[model samples]
Target: MTEQTSLWQDETQSADFAELCSALYEREIAQLANADIQSPQVIQGRLKSLPYYIKRTAHLMLQTQTPLDLDVQNASWSAKQAAHMPLSGQEIAEVNKWYLAQTLTHGLVVPVATTTHIVLDSIDRIDQQNHRFRTNVHGWFYLNDTEQKDKKVNANYRLLKPNKRVMTAACTGHCWVNDHKTNPVIPSLRELLLSCAINWRNFKQPVIF
Candidate 1:
């Protein structure tokens, strides 16, 4: 008796998935080519100029409305046994989608621009009478631009300590919090794009800028 082949072992489906990935990659590269990060207008628009190919791909998946049966534990076990018992095509696709979402949401990081400035909200201040005040005034503490190595510099133009209490710069044109306790890091353009893509994918809807 001949053994029946599993859907996961079908070469056609695997080829199709590879083609889909290639097409998406090409589309993303094309969109990125058109975006000039150094342009003042692009920076002013924040991450609006960047293309969200991941979200767009997710939207296409939503159109299929395919119910996914993703068992995390089972998936992990299947991955471990992949060389012996392979997962189905659907399972592979679901795993890839989940991984893509995870990567876009958390794993990716980009370099900060050298010209970017770190503006902090001054919480403590000194009065005109030489008396230091604990007033939680919402003042601005503009730090110098990052050094050649992307290190944060203080008002004295020195490397800032990690535990220093200061308002750190956020994405351009985005509102920042004045929390005096935790140090904030600026979000890169790719980070912003990834966030938007992830949110759109989760909501299964278009995100308006």
Candidate 2:
């Protein structure tokens, strides 16, 4: 690398970058929670500002030189796998809907912008080879829509790889996900938010569960 490029890389590898990433991550999640709202339109407006926060958090993490914790490392590994997997638009929407519902259900807030950033950033990181994954959404969070009769159309994610399971979502904007057999339930969206909250409360640690 050229000297200029080398210096930039070195700066990213510094302890300061790690601290910045940690702080940004906490801020992003906390901001989502603090934006709690009942009106979808109002919530949408609040969500509009999330992409900047998400991107900043992601960029800092990618530039950091420190070794990430197991959960984060594993999440990145899953993103790599997902990049290779074929995710249809409908599939993506299904997963996003499930997550949104779960977040609202758990009394945690998530704007559409945040969800888009999380999904797109994971894919972008893999495509650009950024060598980082900052999202925990690695599965299809929807079930097959054809089988539903009432068309209530709740979020049922169908995760691929690691586990080819279906997550039957609740319609009450609650964080509930059960499988077809209801045996091995996937991680609910509420859990993800709670992890983020805990990480923020615990000195702005990196929590991408």
lDDT for each candidate structure: 0.29, 0.31
State the lDDT of candidate 1 residue by residue for 139-182, as single tens digits.
22222222222533333221111111111121221222332223
Instruction: List clash counts for every candidate, in order.
Output: 0, 10
> Each prediction's Cα RMSD?
20.6, 16.5
TM-score per candidate, in order?
A: 0.22, 0.22
Off by over 4 Å in 1: 1-4, 7-9, 39-209
Candidate 1, residue 204: how far the Cα is off, in Å: 11
Instruction: Please list the residue runs of candidate 2 whose C-alpha ends up more than 4 Å from where it truly belongs after superposition.
Output: 1-12, 22-60, 63-142, 154-209
